[model samples]
Target: MQPRSPNTAVKFAHQVKHWRLAEDIRAFCAAARQSGAATDWTQWAENYAAAIDSLAAPLGMPPDPPAGQHDLRDYFRGDTYAHPWPFDKDGQWILADDGVDG
Candidate 1:
């Protein structure tokens, strides 16, 4: 099999990063609303994580942690909340980096 191109690899990495961030944000939001050790910071962290994913995805890549992980914490280690891109973004339909968004 042929080795994946640099562009392809980058794209995959980006996607993974993006997804991870989203997961973190979602978790943070949940924790903030709930009462417990979790606090507002938790929510911010999650949002930042999600933002990273969003930014990376546009470059043709997967979200961090490769999606379906236990939680965003395992996926990313950051200080700022990463916002996810709107569903209408081109990256949303990126099936592959074949020059087509889908």
Candidate 2:
């Protein structure tokens, strides 16, 4: 087989790093849910956002990117099946409807 191009190698490395980062974020979210760590959904979202930002820092990513760049908050609000968190009128933590049925 022909040797891989330098650009191809770089892209592969980036892809691997991205995949690992996604897994780490998934695990963090899972553990956070299991732990009942934070009672406030927004606070939990902010904390998770910070955690992900720090995780991406070593990869040369900005914690909060410039305007027009993808904001980490969008990740939490994305179309993915991951349930959104919200507090009810009684202030009890709850999983907000994501508009997608199980």
Candidate 3:
């Protein structure tokens, strides 16, 4: 089942901001990795099919949660089981933590 419908009031205006989209992608990928969904061909195929269907339609799937509405940190918590990724106090995703002076 679809988890939830995205906000449509912002249809004329952009809803998901760039930073949030990037973080969401990262989190989704991380969950897939931890859940072994990355290697699951069946799931991949299903997702691919759905994407294709969306592309074929004049209008694709509705936009997901906007920048402030959804948090990447919480989206995949259950699927990933463990949160290896780090986020700053402000809840922004951290790319890396190299112990080096730049």
Candidate 4:
């Protein structure tokens, strides 16, 4: 998947794009190992992890954590306070034909 922002995440994605192939991957790992933990690789991992863990930090994203009762109702309900909504409208999501706003 691709990162949304042109910040640390985008920079990190570009850094690893060359490692897509297996042979290049081994070489990349070797380079990281040579650099040691106190290096870009570690920072990259931390930034990537933070981007992932954040509720909406990464724009294009992985699956959302499951929502249940007692989960933030605002997450599922729009500003209109619509009930039985299947998505959190406050985020960058839109509704289906049945719920579409535009």
Candidate 5:
């Protein structure tokens, strides 16, 4: 089988990080709402996207697939493990929150 391109690997890593953050934000928003805190979807989406971009930028990755391309879901659907590793399993790709992997 052909090896995945560097761009494709970078995109895959970015997608993984992006979705992880999005899920965290969604959970936080839900908890905040339950506790009567204000929640703004518009601002949240913007901030979330920006945060994802910031996290991805240092890796020299591109932004999420443009709207002109296939849908985001379509772009991600495949054997993602085929992508190359940006960092080794023991290497620090992301800092841990609780002083473990960080």
Candidate 6:
């Protein structure tokens, strides 16, 4: 399912994309650590294959969430679950919190 507010969805997508990029970097670092500092022809080929087989890979299957991150839609939309954001007296998202004049 998608969010009711298009702006909110777009903002969330942007944030998620950034997170995905970071995850990709972390995955690459992990692979490098496993392979060691030096890389011969076989090691290079294996590393390349492993990189593409990672969850962050463009062609690899998606991986499960690290631990949390389940049921984030309600937290972000606030239409169903009471979002823990809007750390103000009023229950409203701030301008910097991806508020779109709602």
Measured by lDDT, the strongest candidate is 5
Query: Across residues 3-102, which tens digit of lDDT does each residue of candidate 2 receive?
Result: 2445555655665666676666666776776787644673565456556443455554223212221233464546433544454445455566634597
lDDT of 6 by residue, 1-102 (tens): 856455556655665666566566556666766778434654565555455443443432233322222434545544533444433344333454464566
Q: Considering every candidate listed, which one attains the maximal TM-score? A: 5
For every model shown, what is its TM-score relative to the native structure? Answer: 0.35, 0.36, 0.24, 0.20, 0.38, 0.32
lDDT by residue (tens digit), candidate 5, 33-90: 7778755774576477567753545554454332321233366656545644333345
Evaluated against the true structure, the overall lDDT of model 3 is 0.50
Better of 4 and 6 by lDDT: 6
lDDT of 5 at 11: 69
Model 1: residues with Cα > 4 Å off, grouped in runs = 1-3, 36-102
List candidate 3 segments past 4 Å from native.
Answer: 1-16, 39-102
Candidate 4, residues 1-102, lDDT tens digits: the string is 644434557555643452344344445556677777356665565455444442334344334444443566655445434455445644444355655566
Model 4 error, position 39 (Å):
0.8
Runs with alpha carbons beyond 4 Å of true place in candidate 5: 1-3, 41-102
Error of 3 at 22 (Å): 0.4
**Candidate 3: lDDT of 1?**
55
Report residue 91 deviation for candidate 1 (angstroms).
20
The TM-score that candidate 1 achieves is 0.35
Query: What TM-score number comes out for model 3?
Result: 0.24
For candidate 5, the per-residue lDDT at 71 reads: 30
